[model samples]
Target: MGLLDGILGQVAGNPEIANLAERIGLSPEQVTAAIAALGAAHTQPGDTVAGAADSTGLSPDVLQQILTHLGGEGALGRLGALLGGAEGADGSGGLGSMLGGLFGKA
Candidate 1:
């Protein structure tokens, strides 16, 4: 795990959430609510911001900006995995598959 491994592990009450809210010009409550909705909807963590944009009426551009600010290249790197393109270290699918295993997708 990397530095963000510990950080990303803490979603609720994470100060970054509030920072993201401020950066996106939204209330922290709104950000959390959107995150919750997306989580329940089975949206990939990497895509949560984009999916939340649709549900919360936030612009995709702003959401992307928020993600970039929060994760930098690490976040960008996850996209391929989230989209089921990048292979995991074990060479058994990618992050999408890993998340599917967690959520019982298939």
Candidate 2:
């Protein structure tokens, strides 16, 4: 799998990110960059989506759509938990929870 495939796999199922990117007319690179920016924002406390839009030159609406497609609020929680090394209720560091931690939701 590609780098994005691996990274995004933490937030979504395989091929889901690719499908969302295609639907939103964004390159996989752009999407990946935005996701990275979002993760950074979680730590730095900046405008996560806006920073991504600025960097990727994608409209905020498009980025919002991508986030929504990825499961929105629940997705963010998962990302935060994942990044923060917080264990899920099952006592394992599941991908979604790990990602939630990354986004500072944990």
Candidate 3:
């Protein structure tokens, strides 16, 4: 799995895809595919969950639930950090502002 996929897997509150899948009523493979789609969508220019739903054929609500389970904006911050916009020494930088805009948290 790639970094984003690994982070998604971890952020869903479990590293075991099967466990999260079972809870969400999807197979592990489905969950994995959805996670991958979510990661891809995150890099695109719009609503991440909605975009993932469009590509993955899952509903936005389901994707949002998964996102919420994965720590929501907090997870986005971590993802941004991993992507290299490390909030800087003063904790103000690309990641924070960019993620804030992404989630309307600004």
- In the predicted model 1, the residue pairs found to clash are none
* Each model's backbone clash number: 0, 20, 0
Error of 3 at 44 (Å): 1.4
- Ranking of predictions according to lDDT: 3, 2, 1
Q: Pick the candidate with the highest lDDT.
A: 3
Using all chains and alpha carbons, the TM-scores for the candidates as numbered come to 0.39, 0.58, 0.57
The digit string of per-residue lDDT tens for model 2 on 59-83 reads 8888777666656645655665555
User: What digit string (tens of lDDT, one per residue) describes model 1 on residues 54-80?
Assistant: 677867676556555534334434433
Error of 1 at 19 (Å): 1.9
Higher lDDT: candidate 2 or 3? Answer: 3
lDDT, each prediction: 0.51, 0.60, 0.63
Error of 3 at 45 (Å): 1.3
Model 1 global lDDT (CA atoms, 0 to 1): 0.51
